[model samples]
Target: NNRFTERNRCPADIEKNLEYITLIWLDENIDDSNESVQMQRLLYKMNNYVLLYTDPHLCIDYIKTIVDENIILIICASLHELVLPIIHSLNTVRAVFLTCNDHLKLTSVCSEYPKVAAICTDQQQLIKSIHGTIQSMSNQTMSFTLFDSNKQNSTRDSASILWYRLLIDILKTLPHTDQSKNEMLDKCAEFYRFNEAELQKIDMFRTSYTASKAIEWYTSECFLYKLLNKALRTEDIDLLYVFRFYIIDLYSQLELEHHKQFRINNNWDKLIVAISWASNFKR
Candidate 1:
């Protein structure tokens, strides 16, 4: 009984507050006569609240009759019905809702008003478009090939360098299985030759030189791995010591990036393993 009393009182409170709030309820089966009477009374009272409940055919008429520019249009039936008029009246209105159809129309509307647009679609295309535009503009302004097809091919060259860096880093962590080690060496040599040949075709001396340097670094890393594995298997102290000294010397010569933590961790692991193996031989 108390709950029922409170519920009955709620509507009167809502009506009192309706003057300060704009409410629109849309439905196909709305009682038109009753709605018009109630809305007319509210208008006569200068309540400042607007309400519309009508089908798509009567939407334009319904919108014109409502005096409040600050109207909340609730779209309950067909989205096309709501979207068309709302878009037409874009100059007067602030916001809208389309609760029905999910189609390209929603996306088109949202694209026009991004701030109030809630339509969902393929976001990847939007992101790609933004990135491409920015990249193109930046390249044009700076006069650099950010995504160049030719002209030293900075992007591709940098990518190749990063790839070799990763391979070398991975090789240092993995334990030496003789067959796997041999396969790795063969692949390194093959890829290095392929990349070096491609770089030489570019006609940019600096790019070719950088590619050559990368090839040398990768080749040396592969050779070092093979030598380390061989020394470990044969318990050759002289060979292990020579490879260790060679690694130290190579480390000094390389202009490695400060952010190569992955490579540094792998190298540290390999160094520890080498030290352990050497101690075992001494014992």
Candidate 2:
């Protein structure tokens, strides 16, 4: 159900656009005689793309090839060992490295090769950076949980809680202006999954459960819309009515002009329909 996993599948246009010139650097020693290699060879042969794999010891030679061809290289190894050689070789080509390390060494490496663009890291940093950037754009201050070693929790649970807290903190900083509220609401809808426990913990909802609680606590229908939409997508009927009531309330309060403005700005039919229904809701 993770939208991220679905979004990362390489599109056909990407292959077509880079078909003639792209090269994929893979670790050949992974399984020289396996179906994976055979399929890779077939792709290379059909598309005239380049594929190379070398032993960890012979990585320097591969680096030389990468530099000589000015090829976009993707290194399939720990960045601690590969960063030095890659920096030595390619002066201008783009590179992506897959790593599990928490060290920010890749940022330093990117500084050496300004052309060497993306350094894909673990999911935690990626999420944090994205949330940080969005909040910064709005000139809002938000705090994130720093998972120091002394925390009394399992690593997995701690990481999850940290991310959840970071997201909640960022949401709290969004401005009360309709434009800002709507933008934040849409973003929350896109990136977050709502849970009752998480909602109850917000300061605005600490008192009671009512239609007003959702709007007062969450600030906008966008979050409610997203929550209901997600619940519907997952067929979670139990939480549907809470979100449904909020959406109906938001629609009733907005003027016709406000609805038009929202539609023009967002261009999302689902949101438009939700707003319309809420605006026209009767007792």
lDDT of 1: 0.37
Poorly placed runs, candidate 2 (over 4 Å): 1-29, 32-47, 65-68, 86-92, 99-108, 121-283
Error of 1 at 163 (Å): 77
Candidate 1 TM-score versus the reference: 0.25
Error of 1 at 174 (Å): 95
Which candidate wins on TM-score?
Answer: 2
* Clash tally, candidates in order: 0, 4
Candidate 1 regions with alpha-carbon error over 4 angstroms: 1-21, 29-52, 77-87, 101-105, 113-283
Backbone clashes in candidate 2 total 4
Error of 2 at 127 (Å): 19
**Which tens-of-lDDT digit does each residue in 77-156 have in candidate 1?**
35444455454554434344444444455556555553232332333332343334334332332221223334424776
Clashing pairs in 1: none
Kindly give the stretch of ten consecutive residues in candidate 2 with the minimal lDDT sum: 137-146
Clash-forming residue pairs, model 2 = 251-278, 251-279, 252-278, 252-279
